[model samples]
Target: MRQSLFVSILHDIQQVNEYFIQTRDATGAPGLSGVQKMTAAFQILQYGMPANAVDEHIRIGESTAIAALNFFTRSIVATYEVVYLRSPNEVDVARLLQEGEQRGFLGMLGSLDCMHWHWDKCPTAQAGAHTGHYHKPTIVLKAVASYDLWIWHAFFGMPGSLNDITVLDRSPLFTELTRGHAHTANYTINNNVYTIGYYLVDGINPVGQRL
Candidate 1:
């Protein structure tokens, strides 16, 4: 990671929760500091390495490394969910529309796609239920992201056998739009004005798709 960016995250995380503070151990020696914990967590996440693979390098036990990862993820979510993971508001809608216009997609709010993440630890008995095209147990993740890389929507935990169409059938994004409470955007292109926004989706039928 870049030095400046890493330092910024360390400072922000410490600001969010004091649990990340480094202090003395039971023997009056300096214990694991927040920097060590964050390092372990980032390594595990960025490399997708086994939890134990980080123990020796980070100077932490396997269990402690895992704990640091959990704590770090939870802290980030708790501290930034409202700003980063929230549904788009009116202001956000306007900004997204402007961005779309600049990119020649006047009515586009974001792109949509579904991915399958293999579940390595899936039980044998439950494997058949989750096995899909990849011939392994997995879970589906559907996401809608804008040009700025802001994920406006995400739905996970679906059985892997389900295709993108089936996943869309169960997604709440459509239901919210149908209820008429979703954020609205208006834009003009080629002397045409459009009120409803659309998303660029991949490998899915658009029968009941949502933006």
Candidate 2:
């Protein structure tokens, strides 16, 4: 994370949780600061390290480190989910259309894709239903991301036994569009005007079908 961004997060988190602050006891021994706890959690999350490994460098017990990770995730969502996680509105759609036109993709809203997140701790009995073409237990995350990497839509937790087609069938990203509630984006291409927008997709995704 950027220095300024990290500082902002730290400041906001402090407001949300006093545990992040450094306090001194009567003997002047300092308790664990919030930064250390949050940093340990970040390392474990970013590097996929075991919870116990953070004890060596962070001096936090394994159970405490786990609690920190849980608290950190919840705090982040409570703090920034409204602004950073919202779907596009009318103004947002207009901006996306402008950006897409500049990039030669007229009426393009975003790029659509699905990724398989490996489930390492999947139970043996559940693995059979979760195993698909990858031959491993996984969960699907279908997303529509803009040029700026803003993920406006994400549908997760689908069983891995399904393919891209099946996943899209279950995804509600296009439900609004199908219901004619999607934002209007009229754009010109090849001297012709069109109203429906499009999203770039990989070959594995269903094509020549209504989106």
Candidate 3:
């Protein structure tokens, strides 16, 4: 590895590390036992190339490389919505709220929509959801975000095998938040303080409080 690789990687991994604080530490997890693992994850997400390329580039195994990529990909989902404020203890729930306010999109820090990332192939069982639903296979990332560029929530790993709206409805954020159970210890959001209420900008979802 180049000397600068770790220097750049260490910084990125630390943020991801904070998010994956080992289940031992406050339910934070997808933790890494060694720097190599975080390094591997960073390389995958930053580059988005196949895992083999990362493994060969870093001289690690294909499985290890794939695992690392998966870790960070989820890490983005887990932490993207959280905003660190002035103090470590203070996370600004309204951190991004200001942007929407200024943009005449007040009371909106998050947008309710489904974005798709293209995929190459669909598996046998999974093909049902992917068939003609989209022109191509895609992993749908359904998320809610604030205007300050802080993502307050995300639902990931929905197989390209399905429609964006269906995936969103079944997303953990949607189910729990709608049922008013989102704040339960087993349920969640950034800072774990979210309630039955979550903020999202409306588009395509024409009903009251859509997923």
User: Which has the greatest lDDT?
Assistant: 2
lDDT of each residue in 19-86, candidate 2, tens digit only? 67789999999988888888988998877788999898889999989988998888888787887777
Candidate lDDT scores, in order, read 0.82, 0.84, 0.54
User: Which candidate leads the pack in TM-score?
Assistant: 2
Candidate 3 deviant stretches above 4 angstroms: 1-9, 12-39, 43-55, 62-99, 174-211
Residue pairs clashing in model 2 are 20-34
> Any runs in candidate 1 off by more than 4 Å, and if so which?
1-4, 42-54, 62-67, 187-194, 203-211
List clashing residue pairs in candidate 1: none
Clashes of each: 0, 1, 8
Quote each prediction's TM-score: 0.78, 0.79, 0.52
lDDT of 3 by residue, 50-80 (tens): 6677655566677867776666666555554
- Tell me which residue pairs clash in candidate 3: 81-151, 109-145, 109-146, 110-145, 119-137, 129-161, 130-161, 138-160
Ranking by lDDT: 2, 1, 3
For residue 136, model 2's alpha carbon misses the true position, in angstroms, by 2.0
> Candidate 2: TM-score?
0.79
Error of 2 at 180 (Å): 4.3
